[model samples]
Target: MVEAQHKKELERQLWNIANTLRGNMSADEFRDYILGFIFYKYLSERMEQYADDLLKPDNLTYRQLTTDQQTILDDIKQESVDYLGYFLLPNELFEVLAEKGKNGEFILDDLGEVLRHIEQSTMGSASEDDFNGLFSDIDLTSNRLGKNPNERNQIISKVFEHLNEIQFLLDDTEIDVLGDAYEYLIGQFASGAGKKAGEFYTPPMVSKLLAKLVTAGKTRLRDVYDPTCGSGSLLLRVAKEVGVDNVGYFYGQEKNPSTYNLARMNMILHGVHYRSFDIQQDDTLERPAHSAKRMEAVVANPPFSANWSAAEQFKTDDRFSDYGKLAPSSKADFAFVQHMLSHLADDGTMAVVLPHGVLFRGAAEGHIRRYLLETKNWLDAVIGLPTNIFYGTSIPTCVLVFKKQRPQADNVLFIDASQHFTKASNQNYLQDDDVERIFNAYTARQNHDKYAYVASLNEIADNDYNLNIPRYVDTFEEEEQIDLNAVASQIQQLDKDMIDIDKTIADFCAELNIKAPF
Candidate 1:
């Protein structure tokens, strides 16, 4: 209970800071600034802790050391770069800047310089790529912040002042307080981002389901990959399922530049060492970054039915070559699937979220589906998801799990979890029970009335390679039979009662010597 309250308080504080920029900029722009400031503070706190530990032997503190002690400062900087993959001078620390702001001093230039120095410190090092341009999205010179330089500095300082009040608890090993808070802020931003949210963030529940699906029956993974990694959430979710160290490495590719930076920051803030993750900014379909690497577990929530070049020449590319035809130029759902399949190891499991159209859409997609089921037999299971579960779109989606080596090659599991979700304000969400029921059905691969089915390969082929959920999982409800005879009896009884009442009325009229209109 204490931890829960702490988390809520931290989230409230961060969101309050985020709203400070609301009047001056858009959600996406302010999001970059607020998160960037938080990341800067996180780095500063980490550096302070590390320096304090190292200085303990010298009976001196980092803040006490002056530039006159050049040799000692150089030694510490060297050590910091080796351990933290970046270096920040005492003056460059976040606290110092906040203090200067409190003293009514200008700090915009210094803050920008410090951020640049952090990136530069990783130069010619193993973590260079990971730290490069990590703060590029936080544009300090943008007119959106203010019309003049002083206004910009004031805004930045106010953000720092608010962030300075929160303690990240870097020394506390038992809790990931800051990391959880960071994720909460990211989720909050995604909620308000609308359709743009789909570009970089996956709903946490969906991420959990995908992670659980891929990591099932396994305690460790050689590596995991996401072809269209968005903020690396799905990749990170896989790590949480098992011990983080159990996953040998993390690999992902995102096309968006700003989201690419966020993914890197998220990794570092989550305590993932820079050396353990490789995130690239490039089109995963057109220019695969980790093409040579085979992933033991892969997951993705690619854009639904996004357009791609689908050039004819891609037919010969290794990722889509064997399919004999490219996915439609207007819809690239199958293209992402094929890309992920190419990197899946022989013993790998991959789960990807795609539109329902991929299940039954004909032409090139149908050919690809038939090839996966009949020719290659890599398709393993299909799980239908609820509609409006995502941030922006309301279309229903499905998760497709594939494996190169299947225990039962002749059967494919189908689970219709569409009806099992709780309706929240403006959206549907999968409760824990809902997720578990689907997972249990997936693992058992048995028939369940109106929920799950295990269809034979022959059955799928008979249906002409349509993997639509309704065809396999019967969720139809039959209406109860009506009782016509009982209804007729009740009608006749009512009519008899009305006739007796009319006769009684006629007798009363005769006693009164008045004519009855009946």
Candidate 2:
């Protein structure tokens, strides 16, 4: 309970800072600035801690080191670069900037320079790709912050001053205070971002469900990959399912440059080393970043029904060539599925969240579904989810789980969990119980009345390859039969009582010496 309270307090503080920086910008616009500042502060704290640890043996503090000591400074710089993948001078640290801002000093120029130096420090290093252009979205000189330079500086200074008051608890070894707070801020931003939220964030419960589904029966994974990585939350959730050292590597690709930077920052803030993750900014389908690599576990919550270049040339691409048809240019649902399948290892399992239309949509989608079921036999399970659970759309969604090597290739498990969800103010959410029930049903792989079903390949073929949940899972509740006899008897008694009362009224009229009109 105390931990929960601390988390809530931290989240409240961070969100308050975000509001202070919101100014006149949209949630999406201000989101970039707030998260970027938080990330910068996190990096500063981490660097200070690491430097202090290294300097403890010398009985000299990192902040007190004189630049005139060329030998010692050079040695510390080399070690920091090798270990931390970047070097920050004492003056460039976040605390120094915050203090300068608090002291009514001009910090815009120095802040911009420090950010640039951070990027330049990784030049020609093994970690260059991970840190390159990571801060490109932070436009310090943009007029959007204010009408003029001074106004902009003042706004930024206020934000820095507010953030300086919150303690990130970086010294705590047991709890991931800053990481949790970062996730909370991301979620808070996503909640207000509307439809654009789908581009960079996945609902936390959905991420958890997918992580649990893919990591079933395994304590460790060779690696995990997400083609549409977003902010890398899904990838990090997969890491949390097992021991931190168990997962070998993390790989992902995002098309949006700004979101790609967020993903890299998210990974680093979660304490993942630079060499352990390979995140790239590019179109995953067209120019596949990790084309040659196969992952043991693959998960994605890609944009629903997104448009893509389904040119004639793509028909020959390896990812789609085997399907005998390219996913329609108008809808790229199956296109993402095929790409993930191609990158799946021989013993891998993949789970993806897609629109319900993918199940029963005819023409190209039907053809792809048939191929996956009849030819490849990779379709393993289909779980239906409630509508309005996502930040943007209210349409009901489903999770499609596929495995390259299945023990029961002749059958597919279908779960209708669409009815089991808690309603929030504006969105539906899957509680811990909801997620567990789905996972348990998935593991059992047996029929449950009005909840789950195991359909044979023959059954799916008979239905013309429509894998819609209602067809397999029978959730129709039989209406209660009306007792006509009892109702009629009660009506007769009521009629007799009314007649008696009328007679009594006539008797009373006669007693009162009044003539009855009847």
Candidate 3:
């Protein structure tokens, strides 16, 4: 419990550091720089700690080692590069740079070069792809920091001072204090970043739900994937549900370069080795990064109703070729589903968050929905979520669970969890109980009057394959009968009381020698 409190305090302090750059630029711009700096700090601290542990027997710290001892330094560099996937010199450590900045030494240049060296250290190594361009978003010369270089240096130094004071405890043996705090800071940025947040951040509760759904009844997953990975929070959440060691590998793709970088940092910060995760930058639908292998569990919270080319050439693509119709160019909700579906292993369970329209929308989407329900019989469940649960949009959304193989292929489960959420600020969120109830009902595959229902394939066919939640779960409430006679009698008595009160007021006004006020 004390650790829990300390974690919260750490998260608070990390978020406070953002204030130093809050007004210098837009939230999106500042978020990139702040998060990049935090990533750098994490990397630096890890490097120094690892090197110190290796040098302990010699009664020498990495910081105190002499420059002439090239042989020892070279051995340490090889080991660090092999184990940590990067190398950092003692002079390039985070504490060294923070002290330099505190002493009013211009560090904007050295800081930039240090970040570059961290990335360059991984060259000719397996982690090169993972660490390459990781720090590309941090531009020290951006005029937005200030009108001149000194102003920019001063503000950056202030930020470094703020971050240097915190003890991240980068250890993962016990509670993941720094990792959870990192997640909290990312959420804070996502919430304030507006629509852009949707591009990279899925609300934690929502990610938790998706993670639980996909990982249910599984002790280990050979591989987990997210096509529109964003900040890779959803992918990490899945690892949390399944033990990290139990998860074989993490795979994801992001279209935004900056968000792609964040995903890599998030993975490393969570203590996932560079070899354990493969995060690529590119549009998943157009150029899938991980198309060759089928994932053991697939989860994604894709952009709602996002536009895509939907060109004729895509019909021949393997991911979409199986589906008879391409999703309309205007809305690619089902397109993403098809892309993920194509990569889902036959034994895997897939869950995705999509807007409600996919449930009943006709035309091309209807054709794709019909294929999944009727022809393939892969549609396992449809769970409706509350509105305003996402960062940007307030539209009602639902989770679609699918499986290539199912024990009970004759029916589909439906859960209406829209009303079972707590109101907080401007958003509504599901409590832990709410999520468990949904997961339990899904696992039980039982009928719940107003919460869950198991519908036969025929029943779904009767409704023309519309997986809308309301069609299965009946949440309609009946209003009480009105007492018109009692109400009318009360009104009559109130009329007499009004007359008495008016007469009393008139008498008082007359006694005061003033006309009675109506």
TM-score of each: 0.95, 0.95, 0.95
| Model 3 clash tally, residue pairs | 0
Task: Write model 2 residue lDDT over 427-506, tens digit each, in one string.
Answer: 99999999999999999999999999999999999999998899999989989998999999999999999899889989
lDDT of 3 by residue, 119-228 (tens): 89999999999999999999899998988999999999999988999856545552367788888989998888888899999999888999999998898999999999
Worst 10 residues of 2 by lDDT: 167-176
lDDT of 3: 0.91
lDDT tens string, model 1, 43-121? 9988888898899988988999899999988898899888888999988999999989877799988998999999999
For all predictions, the C-alpha RMSD in Å is: 2.6, 2.2, 2.1
Comparing candidate 1 with candidate 3, which one achieves the higher TM-score? Answer: 3
